[model samples]
Target: MSVLVFAEAINNKYKKSSLEVVNYGAKLASSQGSNVIVLTNASADAAAELGKYGAQKVLNFESDSLHDNKMLSQIISDVANSHNADTVILSDNSKGKSLAGRIAIKLDAAAVSSATTLPNLEDGFVVQKSLFSGKAIGHYQMKASKKVITVAGNSIGLEEMGQPVAAEAFDASAYNATVEMVETKRVEGTVPLPEAELVVSAGRGMKGPENWGIIEDLAKTLGATTACSRPVADTGWRPHHEHVGQTGIAIKPNLYIAIGISGAIQHLAGVNHSKTIVVINKDPEAPFFKAADYGIVADLFDVVPRLTEALQKFKAS
Candidate 1:
């Protein structure tokens, strides 16, 4: 089966999630005795860099008017058809999920989102995914010979297999964008929270934005990204992008450290997919303790400094 992987670029750079999808696609392609063909909008040099992650050939899309999801989907489907790619791979994010339906319709392929495991061809095309907000795992079989799949962020490790790449530009400059992007303003942060594996998140319990220093201190020492609950974001203590809850961004980091968060169901909906949760809340009945793998019923002020100091010493040693 021909496999195609789309490495979406933003601001001329590729996100970690993009590489994760490529790595996953490459692995799936290898299992079927094939190689990955990547498509991206990044610079030629940056596009070629995907080769180190098992992309044999890269297709560069040079279109500044690709603000419409439909337009992007059409272009991607065209490429898939041109390459005879029966299997299409995408990153499990908002944009990818939105385009998956359109691409599936265009290609007459089955589409699955947030897939946690590679397809098991031994028993047809079985893939595993999280269900019920990660409370359970569901294994599904794609009956269609052709399928579109999105890999969950951080589900697969990035593997570097150095090789020279030859990239060709796909001309899509003439395509008209139905939804024009007037301006793009990104939230500047240490790490892109979606792709972060280790995230240190807090809530209103941090008191005010000034007290966020403790959270940042620990996160910096641990090399983890920082996030916050919706209440904190609504209170103007943290940027809304850092908010993770039912109405905010959903994350499935490997290690999630929730400090001073009460862990409402709304907040848990977004982060319950985390592999391991460590909650640091002084309140014994903070509700977060129920879902935490490790709970520390102590003031964050006392614990955070000591934890950061211990980590610093360990790293120095």
Candidate 2:
């Protein structure tokens, strides 16, 4: 049976997390000697990019109504039924988790979320996932007719398996469900944390919310998004959207810069997947130093301005 991957996108452009999921799913399909099918609800030319990631066929479900979770789940269920897919893969984004959960309930398939690795073909299709704030890895097996998995973002890297291949269109009208998209709230920013290449975060060490301008300036200069530790949000020093910890958003940016953060276990758990970590703190003995790629022991006020100015000079030169 073929493996089906439900790719997520925004404004017809595929998210970086979706590409990682496609790569993971493609490898799993290869291991099982099965073809890979990448599906998207957007009408844009998303299919053209899937082939480079080893997707043999791309299915496009063009409809504005299918953007809602209820409608999207129905469409995915239909595709899974039509192809008799053995495995259905999705990225562990907010939308992916909601859609995958509903699809799993509808299909009665074995479901696994936050998967870090693909299933082992020789071991009865067992998938490995993180547990206990990434303190442990657990393997699970699917015994149902179809297997549904939501892959953790940034856990797997993408590779161009081949050149772009032509994809075929798919019709899933029969399974369309009733749903309405009355309004959409969009957050305006340079880039979303999950999709950003670089992220600069501040914590309680910033002292107060008024001091956030410095962090924002650095993020602006680097074209990075801003995030904060849990304490900052709890103290009302930052909004909840900027919170990044065990209870907040889990991000996997290419470069994560944390300032004035103690790097607690819960906080580190959320950002441990970053490709590079830079920590700025006055406490040289802080636990964050161990996990940081670069650590500076100094007051943030002095360091941040100097750092920003140096970066500006370097950029100018």
What lDDT does the true structure give each of the candidates? Answer: 0.88, 0.83
Task: Evaluate candidate 2 by giving its C-alpha RMSD to the native, one decimal.
Answer: 2.2
**In candidate 1, what are the lDDT values of residues 181-228, reduced to their tens digit?**
888666676778887889999998888998988888899999999999
Error of 1 at 63 (Å): 4.0
Q: Give the runs in model 1 whose Cα sits over 4 Å from its true position.
A: 208-210, 234-237
The deviation in Å at residue 316 for candidate 1 is: 4.1
Off by over 4 Å in 2: 64-67, 174-176, 314-317
Error of 1 at 300 (Å): 2.0
On TM-score, the candidate that comes out on top is 2
Clashing pairs in 2: none
Candidate 1 residue-wise lDDT at 150: 91
Each model's TM-score? 0.90, 0.91
